[model samples]
Target: MAEEFRLRSVAAVAYGPATLFGLAEGAILPVIALSAIDRGATTAIAALVGALIGIGSLVTNIPAGVLATRVGERRSMLLAAAVTVAGLVICLVQAGSGPWALVLYGAGVLLIGMASSVYSLARQTYLTEMVPPHMRARALSTLGGTMRVGLFAGPFAGAGAMHLWGLPGAYCVGLVAIAAAAVLVYRAPELELTAEHRAAAASITTRDMIKRRWRTYVTLGSGVLLLSAIRQARQTVIPLWAAHLGLSPTTSSIIYGVAGAIDALTFYPAGKVMDRYGRRWVAVPSTIVLGASFVLMPLTGGAVSLALAGMVMGFGNGIGSGIVMTLGADVSPAIGRPTHIGIWNELADIGTGIGPVILSAVTALAGLGPGIIVSGVVGFGAAATLWTYIPRSGALRQARAECHD
Candidate 1:
């Protein structure tokens, strides 16, 4: 079994396409706001335009599951790839259009986000079905690790391209990346559908799935939401705090890069620990460390201290790569895996979208330190949620197996 678990096919089949898609997404992220600014939009409107990507994904999550259910995983991915290509094309042209072209660019960004929701959910479902339970965490964690690698590399790729051509060159890079990913997904063999999957044919509504597994959703799902929130909040908190401390933009980027390095290094080890020891071993420590680090960030007086705190936060996050998806897979019924994952991702994204909002709102009212503290408290809540619930479902299977052995 250990020999079987190395799974070179899984590595290539799963991680390869994820890397391309992640790279495309990472490359295009900065382009959205930049494009809007280029079109002469106000800063506030530019920010809103940039956010359309998340909003598009948020709205499409449930529909993505339905689409995956109807079309099957491989086909769904190809379709998403097609949509991404179309979006990138629009973005490529929008850069040269008039100022109202910002709306066109926003529309393009929205389409890309919709495609991402479908692509992400389909791949997660496919992996959940294919990987055995014992090796599930490693497979998914590496999927996440590959994504980190892709996203980390994407900006550099885009910057190089943009320097040669212009803003439109970034979209060209994304187009190439997504096109390659689509080809991989197309050539891959189709997933073998179960009897239940064939029977699902649009009858399995999100409403039906919720009624059945609402308990799991409320408990473990709560943890997923909080974990996502605090994690997303870190994106805003780290940079803003650095700026608050009077750090220069270059210093801030360097600090961020260092923390990201720490994060990218931890995923595989974390997966191994989750697989061999238990999810609790990683879940509790990751959340506590994440929460405590947020609490500690405000105390940092300068560059060295801030970078250290960021590294601590990064380690907490890195270890818990795919924790949400792993837990979702552990409990999702085979009969409606796509729908269940859709709902699970919906919760996760909702948390992701709200995190920055909460942080900004808190910053407006009580100042920055208190907002950081609030996220720290949210981390504690995530730790508590995972602590109480893991044994009830995912971990219990392993515990029983260990006793039997």
Candidate 2:
């Protein structure tokens, strides 16, 4: 009745800045490293820059979410945009190497993660607030699909911007995107708090909030951490190794793009599966398949093998990405959906952001093959954990089917 689908799209647009932050990182990380090298920064310094961002994200993401809940999702969105813009301005104006660049870029990247988390948490909570329970899975799936498309497109766009206009130009583009997101958010409607929501908000304390959703939080956090580790290992290390093996940057980018596209295309079907079967049923097998794909990654050479690996990984991720978020929404404490989603999202970011750094360190210590192989093993191990503890959604699906029949 409220044009639920259109509003969700608008909410997603409100999240465009966060999406841009993600793309900016993916697109600009390689370029940034190259720029560092060009500036005569040591490999250690380059690695440090990456680590700073992760550390900052791990620290600020939870607080950002908490703040979002206190202020309202719309306010949080605007706050995130303002923070991101300020961060960009810092990076744009900063000069010198050593402490100065490190401080500025480190702070910039931290705000990137914080602001991005705010936008993301707000988007998910706002969308869930708008959609009916029956339509939630499908709606989330569509959002996830759009997210995948944005993520996939962002890096390439960043790369193109970098190619044509250099670092400064790319930063300018990111800034423009953030500004556009802020404008969209300003135009989007505020979430109407139902009586239940208002009551929940009034009654739930911070401690009580965590106690209420502990199982849901722990499960989602663990699952996303494992998922992020598996995915980031490839996203970060494999391409570098591929480059060392004489593959061109453009070729590597193409492979990554293809994988992401495959994931985006399959998201809706995966959501349908979750809606029909259950979240757990879709997640468990897909998680395993994703791990297996990572395990298979190091077993081949050149673009063909990498492409195959990407396809496998994409298929696995596509099956459950949206459903997972919907599951988070389902289990979240009604009063603090934004805060709960943010905490889990932070865990996700921790896993994702720290993943590349950890994998890279492993590769540096023991070479790429062993590092990648271990990543696969760890992912599989995580999958086994999910299988053992998480409940299946099949019963819910069956009940609905019976009703329909």
Candidate 3:
């Protein structure tokens, strides 16, 4: 329990930058979309802003993983912090005209995503080492919940900073958060690699490692695909629908903020479920809620309706996402934990990046309601599989096997 508590502290410190930047990053998206439009970009180009960031993450994930393994988790985190800090500095300093700003934005987002991958992988590796397997889901759930709290709090700060100081302020906010995160991480005690862990790490090459961990890799990718599709509807299309229905951006921000809060609050109980019942038990309901939220979106008629939709959607996202995150870390081999977890979340980055583009097309062709409905239905289908594959009994068996091995 003490070890779990320590792991939790590390996770909280590690996740702080993400929380701060998530707020700034999300706020900047709408601004970027609007700016691209203002700069005479077509809808296609505007959406490219996000796409470029995803591409950057895809390009960087593997290397980031490898690098973390080579450097050790603490050093990797420091490097990640430096890279993110640099990107934020660039955005803050280079807020100029033309495609150059786009380039800088893409660069910053890419670095952030890359750093995110490394930080996440290292954090997972560190946690796995500290916390016992049975407590893992609960610990990870706590981490997931913390992340949601960041998500919940970040946007409001971003919006406020943007309102008070414009894009530069938002960027500054992210920069400060990144810097603060660095300070927190640096202050925390570092985890060192022992000789056995090092030998285990060294015995496997990247290609060999992937082959061995493909089960986890495949699961991560499939989960990402499902979540990405759902997130597209929720983050991009749902908000657009809200705007079209005459809600102010502030109101929309509030809706998102509230949902994030709900997500944060739910993490503990969800983690408890995963701890007691197993990962799949908690994950199944989460994915279903995520899907159901989209299905329920069209029913929202006013601010009250929108808020309700947001709350439901947020709950689903919060619950479902926690399971996936915890399990991804759970199934990964100890030797290649960083590399494996990095690859797992890179899929998430890819899904997030491509989400807006795909959903935009759906919204253009079929109207937001139909598009969102499809997303929800897809989520339901994805959620249905968890029961079969990840039952509590199965997970228990697997956990026992892992322990024995």
Candidate 4:
């Protein structure tokens, strides 16, 4: 039975490439801005150049879905890998000032970012095809787990290389990681479509696909978007709050690291609970816990208090490892799935891009604490949305849960 399938079965096929891809991304993130600065751009321009990568991902997400649907996930990843290598090559050799350098640098990072959306969408689609509904949460959670683990470890690897070769060394590290991921993917099996899948694919247009589920996309999708916003807030809120309290960079890093460690440990348990019970069993509480933790961050007056708040925030996040993706999987159709998940992912990424902006804007106008509290409010809003909607939106999954009982 699909339920009897062990999580270990696809370790290499799914997790290995995800880890390598994530590692490549994580390693490059710290250096993208530095590389821009190294290319003779001022700080402001460098930050803007660095942002191109994210902008690339955000704009291309839905297109990536179409790409994956047409070419298949594995091929999409290979194409993405090739694009990353080209981007890295340009970053390595291109130099000097002027509009050309800026254009070249901007182009390189944009390609890398665009490749990221393809890689992510393909990977998610691949796992959805490979895993059955009963164990999907675990499969995808473990997938998220592997990617997070790589992201956590990637900086150390990139840092070590930079001590010897400067900024170029870090870019080389990313090059190698992405090249290796491509190799792993090249050797993996193609996604095999069953007769049922074939028929579904033939009958439905992606447009019709959205038409059938437009309400869910507009309504239910908002819950996941809010969840994405709250999740992304963690990056900004803790550090800003810590700085507001006059904590040093090193102290803030330590507190954030501890919180991350807690966050890393929750994926499997979260998936297990979601699969065994239902998404709501985990979603509602995770949202509230995360929201409450954000609300508590500004109240923490010292490093110790901030550390506790960070830990709570971490757990709140950790326990919902694959919640958004799982929800996407739960609602996605066999036909035009890439399109469905792509749009779903686009919503989440939109939230991801905007969350910090909203916080900073509010902080600028209202005060730091209030901005953070507003994120908590977003979390509460997410919690309410998920609680009210998950049952209605994911009724198929709910019916399956009832049957299991």
- Best TM-score among the predictions, by candidate number: 1
Better of 1 and 3 by lDDT: 1
Q: Candidate 1 residues 1-405, lDDT tens each?
A: 763555567655578889999899889887788888887778898899888888989999999999888889888989999999998888776455466687788888899999999999999988877777777788788888888878878888999999999988788889999988987887888888766646764678999999998998998899989999999999877789999999999899889888887888899888878887878888889999999999999999999999999999999999998788788887777677899899999999999987888888888899999999998999999999999988543645743443463
TM-score of each: 0.95, 0.84, 0.86, 0.93
RMSD of every prediction: 2.7, 4.3, 3.1, 2.9
TM-score, predicted candidate 4 vs. hidden true structure:
0.93
User: What C-alpha lDDT do the candidate models reach, one value each?
Assistant: 0.85, 0.68, 0.67, 0.84
User: How does residue 223 of candidate 1 score in lDDT?
Assistant: 91
User: Which one wins by lDDT: 1 or 2?
Assistant: 1
| Ranked by lDDT, top first | 1, 4, 2, 3
What lDDT tens digits, residue by residue, belong to model 2 across residues 39-156? 4468887666556556666777667667766677788778888988887776665476666666666677667766666666777777777665555666677777766666676666
Model 3 TM-score?
A: 0.86
Q: Which candidate wins on lDDT?
A: 1
Off by over 4 Å in 4: 1-5, 194-206, 392-405
Which is better, 2 or 3, measured by lDDT?
Answer: 2
After TM-score superposition, the amount by which residue 294's alpha carbon in candidate 1 deviates from its true location, in angstroms, is: 0.8
**Candidate 1 Cα deviation (angstroms), residue 270:** 0.9
- lDDT by residue for model 3 over 1-405, one digit each (tens)? 675566556565555644654554554544556555544557887777655555666777777778767777777777877887776676565555567666666666666656666666666666666666766777676666665566556656777887888767666776777677777777766666677876677666678867887775565456656666666557765567688789998788778767767766776777677777777677677778888777888878888887888888878777665565666666666676677767776666666765565566676899877777777776776676555555455346546756775
Query: Which window of ten consecutive residues has the lowest lDDT sum in model 3?
Result: 389-398
